[model samples]
Target: MDVTQFFKAPSGPASMKRKMAAEPSDAALKRLRNDEDNDNDEFNGDEDDDRFMHGDGLTEAHRNLLDIVDSAEEAPATIDLPTLKRYVLKLEKSITRNEEMRVRYPDDPLKFIDSEADLDEDLHNLMGVSAAPELYPNLVSLGTVSSLMALLEHPNADIAIATIQVLSELTDEDVVAEASEEGEEGMKALVADLMGHQILDVLVQSFSRLDEFKDGTDDKQGVFNILSVVENLISVDPTIAEKVVSSTTLLTWLLSRIGMKQFDSNRQYASELLAILLQTSRENRLKLANLGGITSLLKAISIYRKRDPKEADEVEMMENFFDALCLALAEPEVKTTFLEEEGVELMIIVLRERKLSRMRALKVLTHSMTGEGGAACSNRFIDALGLKTLFPIFMHKGLKAYKKAYKSHSDSEEDEHVLSILASLFKTSTPENRLRLCIKFSENEFEKVERLLELHEQYQARVHAADMQFERDRIAREEAGGYDGDEEVDAADMRYLNRLDKGLFTLQLVDLVAGYLCTQASEDLVREHMAFLLNRKGKDFDLFIKVLEEYAENTGDATSETNSERALILTVVEKLQIISSS
Candidate 1:
């Protein structure tokens, strides 16, 4: 498969010639035509012009069959199994007959043009299968998919586009997902069958033949259908998804297609496919990252950093770029390359200068600083002067600033994410980096630590309110016969399972920072704000303590000696204990 098929456009006459050459052999066409003749003698005329030929000079039998299929395409109606299969066979026969006619009448443009119209109608009939997916298995067994796929390489662009539409309808994600929910074999089986027949290679061949920039309607719709088919396939199975993203031509095409300045449905879909592929597997993510996918993605997103996409479709395209980038950064290889390419600088610029993309940049940055890549990203983040840029936003005061900026309350997910990144920095900090971060906070008279404590208190209050609400709701439910005999226990289990619902991770993050400050800055500096970390909802303090104890216990098994992060957490636990005692 030429991975770069998307880079080139389909040729006009030359492409048609190739399809003409690839048509079924003379014997197969003769057999199919004979079968059609036997089945539809009434439509077979006597004279050369009268016999199976239209005003456009198409075969009389072929023209009549097309009329039947055309009416069936009027609405989302299902043709019975026997009739649908026969129609499929008839369509294949028509395509085969057309190929034979093209070969026999190489000089007869009228013959080939009418044949192409018949092929288009037959493809439309097959697309009606989208409304009746239960018949998909029968269609597959009848070898309809393989035949349609072959038409993708058809000489006529309209015929190929029509074939693409049929395939897209057959493998649409929603159609397949709905089928899967009902335990029916849908896209999964269809894609597996397609993969068996080397559908990807055919797609790439068709892709290289068409140019998006200069293509006519048929060619453009062809591009859309090809991407749609691939998207549907990938969304169905992991193995097939891997096979696709792992393709060098496909990866390159997707990257190039999305970078085009003209935003359209196909470009938007290409962006979406890239994102889904990356999100599906680490291998896909790594594959694209290695292919300079990140650079392509950032360039696309950077276009919208300062300026908002005016059209809704353009906005969706920009969103796909952001989503794809976030998933891409999850790969360690991509993260290292991202840092190497000054991606952090771009994100900083977005946050600092671009209002529309500010929080999106924050999200990308947060995802970048997580998992195995977190330490590397954190180190690079500091080196890129990320701290100088991030801390100011983190320390911004007042509701107006909050609403205008991140629009997150003091302990909203956005704020929690900012704290999460801080925790990651401290968790992965070298002593040198640790001291630098501490000095950053101290430079502003430790206002950063004070704010962390203030945020912790705010979250603690919310946790308290949540606990009260849960208790009240629980009591009300118990008195109102809301519980089944086993329901009370089930409710308790749910509460236990969601122990972190009270923003425990964010609270721990605050303590993680406070613990770091205590080790580097004056203990009194942390002590002044230590009370801010105390639980506001009476016995809820025990829950906070339990979270810290669990962290210490988990760390004790992972390491023989206490790391600074663990030690700092223990220090925070000790301080909280002191506050509880007092």
Candidate 2:
């Protein structure tokens, strides 16, 4: 006869099992009554017998047990509107009692400890609301949302942590997915209410007070729960990512946290959150740049520049930092900041070191030296003697053996990034640096040009195979009457997309690099080496011109910049055509 069982809410199967376990069997109760009767006979007194008997020929204790069992049987099996209201009422009372006790006896833990424990239990019990997220609006209407939010600033860290756990559970993605359309609307209203209550500001401020090392597990879990809450909120409303960085100290806290020397779960989580925020909006990216985020990320990731991460989690953290840096570098202003912080030099060192960071560093360089904003980075890259490192990778030298010794890496992926670096230099470099680039192809007996042609053939074969497949699919579809009479334009568009997907894009890049070297490099040597390679493959300059023509035709809108790039590529195509005619 557990009194706790009388108060327990009718949760699902688990609660049923607990209720059955707590109840006494009928035989056990009968035996107990018989034992009580024997004891009564031993006492042999009317007063004792009268105290045990009731008017219905049963003991008063046995009748009370029957009443408890009846009430338990009559309890609602699932949470509905009335049950939710009761839970809310219970929670509100617990919160009020806890706050009152804390206020009345601020200096005495003993006086308020029981109330604090009760409040904590109530907060956790509220997590059952997540199962009925469609009722979130009702929870909000009951005014407990504010009470729960206020607990984020509670004087007790445990209370704040418990509140975070509840919020995290409520906003969880699985819960959101379980919701219907009406439930989604309810979730929206709930989140809107939380935002109106300054949720982001409160969450950011909590970071300073919640020390993860203070109580070890509890505090660590508190910090993790806080991150989960933020992640859940963002998942519910992606636009909150911009609001998070724009309106609060979260970005700043994240930057400082990840910059800490010691590696921990919170630090890793902070890095991941930072990456998510930066990837959300251009405004977020620009904000990071203004805050010296580039410098901070560089310092944090520099630890692994020469060495690999010790564990998989650290590897993930390092990748997050790199991801954040690359996203930040998308902004022109951040690219400038990246260059000013000697980011190009660091990347070059990373490339030369050939650590796990090498491939990612190459990706960062490709981003840094892309588009019109990358001119300065391109110049700084050459000025830093980055070519000495770029060429060997371009030629695929020593990479296979290194890949075997350390980690398996994609040779094609390495080739793509290296070729991208070269393409960027061709597009963004000054005349002097452009000559320096062309000389790299010439200095190694046209070795770079030869490698370029080999890649061209390789990707050309891939594109050819894909084109054949597309043709076969098209023929089958035509035979089967799969095409509408008016879908010729649509069919042509799909073919182009299929080609791009199956190496046409990389093939265009290869041809673009070859075109650059053919026209920009020394006329006799590079053209001859390229022509000799093409001819040896039983191809000619016409192949390069065809790829270039196709590339320029699809080179996007005819904006002045696009027109200029298209004009340059067309000029290269014309040159190749003339060279072929000769």
lDDT of 1 by residue, 476-533 (tens): 8878878886887898766644545776556666656655555444455554444444
In order, the Cα lDDT scores of the candidates are: 0.69, 0.81
lDDT of 1 at 346: 93
Backbone Cα, N, C clashes tallied per candidate: 13, 0
Steric clash pairs (candidate 2): none
Q: Once model 2 is optimally superposed onto the true structure by TM-score, how far is the C-alpha of residue 280 displaced, in angstroms? A: 3.8
* Model 2 lDDT, residue 485, Cα: 59
Output the worst ten-in-a-row residue range by lDDT, candidate 2. Answer: 12-21
TM-score of 2: 0.82
Model 1 accuracy (lDDT, Cα): 0.69
